[model samples]
Target: MYRIGELAQRHGVNNDTLRFYEKHGLLQPSARQENGYRAYSDADDRRLAFILRAKSVGFSLSEIAELLSIEVDKANRVCSDVKELVDDKLVKVSQKIIELERFRQSLQILSDGCCGGPHSAEHCTILQALESFEENDPR
Candidate 1:
């Protein structure tokens, strides 16, 4: 058996993460020591590892909980669900990539237009461009 701190240290997770998992029902109830401190078993360590691995792969807590609740015999069903979640995340990731590329292009344009020589704000093209942007932007 391990105390909460020991379990956290063994798993390389913070105590708050373990407590959050318990609060979210991702972890089973912990046994209590005679002094009322929580005691964890090897099974708890396995469960925490599973949760961390799932999170590393981009599974949300709720999604991981659903996946964990699935019976071992329903492997195909679990696979389908996980696949759908991954596909959705992929779409969002692709959109973000596009947005970041656009932002990079805009920044490049600003940098390219700026004069490298030292200049006052009143004569700076970069500042002028920023002022124009502020005037044109609605928010």
Candidate 2:
């Protein structure tokens, strides 16, 4: 068994992260020592690894919880259910990428329209375009 600090250090996460995971119901101690310190078993270590791996792949806390439930109840859940969750996340990520690219293109247009000289902001094309967009935007 390992103490909370030892587990956190071994996983390269802050003590607060371990506490937060506990609060979020993503992690639990296997037992407590007489001094009131949390003790982790090998199973806890494996669970932590699963949580970290899911987070590294962009899963939110809630999503990770769902995944964990599915994993623990494997007799009732199938691989297709996991694939569906990943597919939804992929669609959201792709849409965000498209929005970011559009934003980049707009910024590039503003930059290209500017003289980029050492002048005052009284007649800056970038600022003017931004103001125009703000004024004309329906949203």
Candidate 3:
């Protein structure tokens, strides 16, 4: 049996973070002591470790909860559900990479257009491009 502080310390997490996980229904203690202190078991330690691992792999708290729900179901023995979630995240990550590439290209174009001459700011090509881009853009 371990108190909340001891459990958090053993796991290298803050006490409030453990409390937050409890509040989110991701971690629960085995029982409460008479003094209202939380009493955790080895099982709680294992569960918290799982939660941290899931977060490290880019799983949100809600996503971890969903995975946990499926994990608890002894009747359904399938891996497709977890695979689908991971596949969806991959698609989203791919789309974000594409968007970031486009943004980088746009910045490169702007940087290339600048001469950095000792001229007035009003004559800056980058500024002119930005000012006229919105009006000329069809998208």
Q: Pick the candidate with the highest TM-score.
A: 2
Candidate 2 residue pairs in clash (backbone atoms < 3 Å): none
Task: Kindly list the per-residue Cα lDDT of model 1 for residues 58-122, writing each as its tens digit.
Answer: 77888788767762347557577767766887788789899999999988998899886866768
TM-score of candidate 3 on Cα atoms, chains taken together = 0.75
* Candidate 3 C-alpha lDDT tens digits along 77-96: 47888888788878887898
C-alpha lDDT of all candidate models, in order: 0.83, 0.94, 0.88
The per-residue C-alpha lDDT of model 2 at residue 51 equals 93
Candidate 3 Cα misplacement greater than 4 A, ranges:
111-139
What shift in Å separates residue 136 of candidate 2 from its native position after superposition?
A: 0.9
TM-score of each: 0.75, 0.92, 0.75
lDDT of 1 at 81: 73
Lowest summed lDDT across 10 adjacent residues in model 2 is found at 10-19
Model 3, position 84: C-alpha lDDT score: 82
Q: Rank the candidates by lDDT, best first.
A: 2, 3, 1
Best by lDDT: 2
Q: Give the TM-score of candidate 1.
A: 0.75
lDDT at 29, model 3 = 92
